[model samples]
Target: MIPSVLPTYNRADLTFVKGEGVWMTEADGRRFLDLGAGIAVNVLGHANPTLVSALTEQAQALWHVSNLYNIPQQQTLADALVAQSFADTVFFTNSGTEACELAVKMARKYWFDKGHPEKVDILGFEGSFHGRSSAGIAAAGGEKLTKGFGPLLPGFSHLTWGDIAAVNDAITDTTAAVIVEPVQGEGGIRPMEDDDLRELRHICEEAGVLLILDEVQCGVGRTGKLFAHEWAGITPDIMMVAKGIGGGFPLGAVLATQDAASGMTAGTHGSTYGGNPLACAVGNAVMNTVATPEFLSDVMRKSGLFRQKLEGLVASHPDVFEEVRGTGLMLGLKCKALNMDVVNAGYDAQVVTVPAADNVVRLLPPLNITDDEITQAVERLEQAAIQVAAQKD
Candidate 1:
């Protein structure tokens, strides 16, 4: 029988009925360890009490109002974000794709308002995923993403990841901005080097081109930092953030410096349900928890343990895993065989993981996962490795 839902996703047969922290209960009453954390969206883990309370309280008081009116909850979230990041202003959106759309528009508008209306070109890196909007597909410029979506929105160019010289050459009078993911999540957990990011910043500054970072997947404390770009000691003129900020709720934000946001005036862009009171309340809860020093430090400590265990797992099963890469809880296991094999084996072991490009099995655990959970996750991976090895033989 045909399912009612669209067939866009190759979904597993298991139905998850409930969740708590890093574990989820399947319909058959099987408890599975969820290491993917809903593709890194469940930052504080599933069914967090703080988030639940915030949502419940906001739902009872207010849900959504037009952007024409003042939403104190939205203002509070914006203020909290600005207080912690380089942005002077924040624009709310419903998802990362909308944030990407706004980032593109704002960058182009910045140059246009500065009397360089011809400067509309944007440069993006290869192997980066920037959601599924038209601008996003063009910004990413991946054949797989742009294949069916033909005659894509133009004015975007691509450069090899980490290629400084290419970036330098790409910057021209027509270039409005350069978009990148500090850590390429869908590109198989490839992280841009600190030095490389700094170099890109220098090049962009000298060439007078804006830097737009797509932090939708790697931001909001996923990489043990408030944002992954914080690791490079540099800041983007415009940044796109989502996923973890909502703590499983559908929310996204575009942050920009005052000067960078100068082009955006009242009614330039807005979202009907974006930054609604309920979303903002949950965002506030997530920010309050993940933005603290103690919480971030715990993430780092847990990251150390996970990395050590992952290294050992790779060493023990050289035939299954080729290497371990990525930072913080956003890790990837580069596989020696088909990445799907490893993912399927993980399912067989009662664990959940995500598959990405470049033959990588992504492991994006919740920031607050316990040490014992980390050990258990590694053990499950070990079992998956054994199963895949047997299948190969």
Candidate 2:
């Protein structure tokens, strides 16, 4: 029997009623330390006060005016994004999936406007997740995402995950762009080497192919930088942003360089509910706090602290944890035991974690997680590991 809610997700039995900072209160009143941060969406943390204030004040003033007319809040957010990023223009959307759709369209339209409609192929990599949309599924080129959905969107090619040579070989005259994630979240937090990313950018430039970066999961201060690509010191011609940008509010945007966006004229693209006052207001608040050097430096310092602790954790429990992978707050523990067993044990130990591919348990705590909270989180993880070890023994 189909339940009222779709059974698409293998949801946990625990029901969270409320959240504050890095903690969530379950229906049974159990306080669980939230290390997943809603899959890196709640950057400032659950029920962040600043985000709440921004949403409430905007709710009282205005909500949705659509893209029919000019929106000040949207303009302000666009300005901020452009100022902080390599983009010269920004287009808002309701989710990362929408942003992915627009990115594909923009890339294709760019070549079309330049009198080269035949150049439509986009090169993607294995273990890359764009979104669940038609364009996204095809770009991912993964059987799991495209099994039932046939007659898939064409003009997308898949390459080896970290092979620069394959990327070089894949880009031909027909190639329109190459899309990638700086650090793969759903693909088990695999971070591309900085040198490789720089080389990818160089290759795209030489081939006259546009580079599109999918930063939806690792942007907005998640990687201890404004974006993970910053570490490589290379910029994408087109970039996708979401998740923490709105501090838990559903919001997303596609940013592009002027040349890349030239084809997207007035009627080329738009959305009804995108860039609404409510979402932008929250997004503004998030940017105000996270874009600061002090905040980002703190995030880096804490990331070092947290990673050091996780290294110790991995050492202490070789029977359960294999190693740690990732950067900044987007860390993951590859499990010697089953990743799901560790995650379930975390539930017993009052800790929350998210699971990804390659048998990894992700720890994406709030950027503002306190030093004390870091200590507590590690202790709780230790407890979970002990429980899993016990079960295994």
Candidate 3:
């Protein structure tokens, strides 16, 4: 029988009762090594003590307050985000999609406030996923995302991924912003090269177009940096961050430079549930943990270890894995076999993995996952590969 809930997700058969670190316990008492990390949302892992404590403390004190009122937690989180990155101001939201929406509006508004109301076109790359919203779908230009959604919020131009010439041609006087993911997570963990990023930055700067980076999936310590774009030594004028920023709680933020945010005056944008005390409290905890130099260095060291192990796994199971791609913990295993076949095999091996476009299986473990857990995850992946190869044979 079909469940009462909306049939949006291709719901997996298993039900998880609880989770801790990189492990989740199924309803049937089976324990699974969780490499997917809830699609990279659980940055600090499930039920992290620090995160739990922060949430609990905030809950005990206050949960919700009107945006009209000043919230210290929200201000504190915003300040931390500003301090850690290129942004001078931060706008909180409930999810990455909201952040993306605000980013688009803010960019267009920036130009509009400057008397260039026609500069509303936003250019997005070919294989990027920017969440499921009117602006996001139109910006992504993916058939699967925009098929039935006719007359998608217009003014979005699609460009070939990593093509500097196309980008140059696309940036006309009407182009208000260029939005791209530093690492295309749902498009199969494709990391944009540093040189290409620099070129894009230069082009945007020369063209006077704002660069909006959707770091929703790759930011907040997922890439062993505070944000993935930091690896390329370039900063987007407007950046959308989510996923790990909340440490499994529902929180997102759009960050921008002071001049870039000039359009967003009082009453320009607001969110009811955004920047609530509970969410901000958790965000503070996550930022405190992830933004620390020692913590980020550990993430880099762990990423190196994970990369070496995954390369070895690919070597041992050439029939299953094509190659390993992605930066830091945001890794993907491009598959020689069907991506879903490997994912299903991972189920049998008691490991969770996420399938993406381009025949890739994503391995997004928590930043705080232990070395022992990393070794265990690799072993489980090896087992899944073996099982998949046997099925093909």
Q: What is the TM-score of each candidate against the true structure?
A: 0.99, 0.99, 0.99
Off by over 4 Å in 2: none
Local lDDT at 120 for model 3:
97
Tens-digit lDDT track of model 2 for 195-219: 9999999999999999999999999
Model 3 lDDT tens row, 300-389 = 999999999999999999989999999889999999999999999999999999999999999999999899899999999999999999
TM-score of 3: 0.99
Tell me the deviation in Å of residue 393 in model 1.
Answer: 0.6
| Candidate 3: pairs in clash | none
Output the number of the lDDT-best candidate. 2
Q: Give a tens-digit lDDT track for model 1, residues 1-393.
A: 778997889898889999999999999999999999999999999999999999999999998896989999999999999999999999999899999999999999998899999999999989989989899999999998999898999899899888878998888889999999999999999999999999999999999899999999999998889999999999999999999999999999999999999999988898889999999999999999999989988898999999999999999999999999999999999999899999999988999999999999999988999999999999998999999999999
After superposing candidate 1 on the true structure, give the runs of residues whose Cα lies further than 4 Å from its correct spot: none
Residue 268 miss distance in model 2 (angstroms): 1.3
